[model samples]
Target: MACLLAVAAGYWVLGRGTPRPTGTWAMGALLGSFAVAFASYAPLVADGLEAIVPHVARLLSNCASLAAATSVLAISFQLNLDPVEARRRIRLRLALFAASAIGMTLLFAYEYMTHRSEQVFALYLLLFVSYLGFAVVDFLLQAVRQSRTTRRSSVRLGLRMAALGCVFALVYVAYKLTHVVSAGLNLHLVPEHSQCTSLVAVPCVFSVTCPALAVLLICLGLTLPAVVYPLSQARRRRWEVASFDALGPLWRDLSNAVPEIVLSPVDSDRGSSADADFMLQRRVIEISDGILALTPYRCRTVQRTAQSLTAADTEEAAAAVEATVVKAALAASKAGQFADEVAPPSAEAASRKDLRGETEWLLLVAAAYARVGDTGQLETVGA
Candidate 1:
């Protein structure tokens, strides 16, 4: 109970940063239900609370599980997919889960009142196993679907966390099932034996431990972004500044070199066309250098893009130029340097493109360019 309260407090504090209404409400419901369930069992094992406590706890757990399930459904609804369809599915699932929870809660209450040993055990087993299976299946299916569709890194991280939660739930379910089967088998084999108490004790330990561990793990997973988001933003800002700083010296060098290259055209058409190409090349080189100076993370990507261009040009200058443009676009994508000024390849080639090797090369260059840009920015700021 104390551990759960601490987790709840932590979540509340973190929730202050971002208002995730449904998530917060769901967490609160789950914790509240857990507290009630613990209170119900703790008395039976330890200090021995009033007879009513255990019953109340059982009821609370059932209700809380229903509420938590609803919250998950709510999250799916708010995921910005097809809203009408999502809402419809969520409503249907929520209704079914609620009905199951209510029915189980009623059976639990009746069993407690009557003290019918076999029926009570059966009700508990069924409720626990069913909920565990349903939760795991639902969460994994949703996580897999989201992972395939979502482009956002943060969203993908969240989906991974959800998948982990499902796995944990599965482990808990399996542990419970093993205990249930062992106890049932023991009871069947020794109808008059009291040795079946050990089988019951095994399940008791699992019931207590699984919920506690699961709650902690799930809460931690859900709350991670609250801690990580700020750090990620800070890192991005630092990289941006460094990239700009690295570009300075390269830009100056290119500015000085370009006029000389233009004055003495290397080919017959070099005077007009070559000067433009030289300027463009200088800009690209400066950009690449800038990215290199900024962040070590993307340097290899930038280098690879540059290499692809060089190789293509070696084969056929015109073909190389065209390939370079395509490679640059792809490189920018791999580097995540989605600058508006960086044009994509022509639609015709981009659609039917067999540019695997070429694309990889460009991606490397773009990563390097982004790093240089960051380094340049840092230098400029520091200076």
Candidate 2:
């Protein structure tokens, strides 16, 4: 349960921008339920106590639960109630808290006066616990129904998980109700048996088993956003950044060689005013077109040199070789060396399926031009 709370806290920090009323209430419910469940079974760890500690834990748990139910009720109705209605709700919760505090005091007093063992559920179990169970179940069912009717895939999936979590919570509450009735009537649901036969059977229907199972479901439902949302956002950011980095060199050098290839004027301050994705695409297209336009000047010596350098069988190497070949061809065209023009040969594929690959290839092209084509070979390409 502490682990679950930690996860929710992390998620809250990350997702503060888009707060949902339902999600807030669900987090409260998880925490409240965890406290009560943990308190019920704390005896296994410790030997002796005033016995009042568990009662106190149970009381605080009930308070948290009642508050959670109210939140869920508001969430289900989608009612961002006006200030007047909101104040009324707050007053009612305050009244419940006062009553609960008084009730807990009385329980402690009874234990102090009589010095007898106190039943944990003696403090208004049926009234509060049953209401909490129904309220949460109602909210989950509403969410599930709404999700079924909704077209959004992510909402539908998340709601279904919430519904499953609530079902487990319902089972846990059912056990609590059974305990309440049995305790009130002075009867054990797990009836004691007296028999001469040596065989023995044990029944633990009123045990912590149900609540424990419910904890697993609730924690899972609450923590998924913490895991999934951040990773998806991170991936998108990386893709955009990679695209810009890989295409930078080619965009710069090629645009310098043939200014007309760049469709839009550069951003005076940013050096490019286009959106990252659009700019990257434009750069790729413009460079390809310029290379095609210069194809008639392809030199045999330069193509052979490029083929040898690109023999490493990698995209990066191929891109660098291609850059050198293009620079040599552009220089030759400027010198009027190819008196008769021939059609350009079929070019190799970019083979860049993702942003990373695209970025790497483009960056290699830019870096190679900067490294080996610094002789200003394309200075007279248009002359």
CA-lDDT, candidates in order: 0.50, 0.55
The C-alpha stretches of model 1 lying farther than 4 A from their native spots are 1-51, 152-158, 175-205, 252-383
On residues 204-238, what C-alpha lDDT tens digit does candidate 1 reach at each position? 43454555555555555555565678777677555
Q: Please provide TM-scores, in order, for all candidate models, with all chains considered together.
A: 0.54, 0.50
Q: What does the lDDT read for residue 218 in candidate 1?
A: 53
Instruction: Please give the range of 10 consecutive residues that has the lowest summed lDDT in model 2.
Output: 194-203
In order, how many clashes per candidate? 38, 1
Best by TM-score: 1
Candidate 2, residues 1-383, lDDT tens digits: the string is 54555455455445556555434544555455455445434544222332535345545555555554554444435333465675675466546545655665575556545653325443455655556676667667776776678664544565677677677667657766776676567676634332223212222332344445545554554455555666766765566556566556656555666677877775631223235556666666777667666777766566565566554666556655666666676676667667254434424334666654555566666666665555423221111
Error of 2 at 53 (Å): 6.5
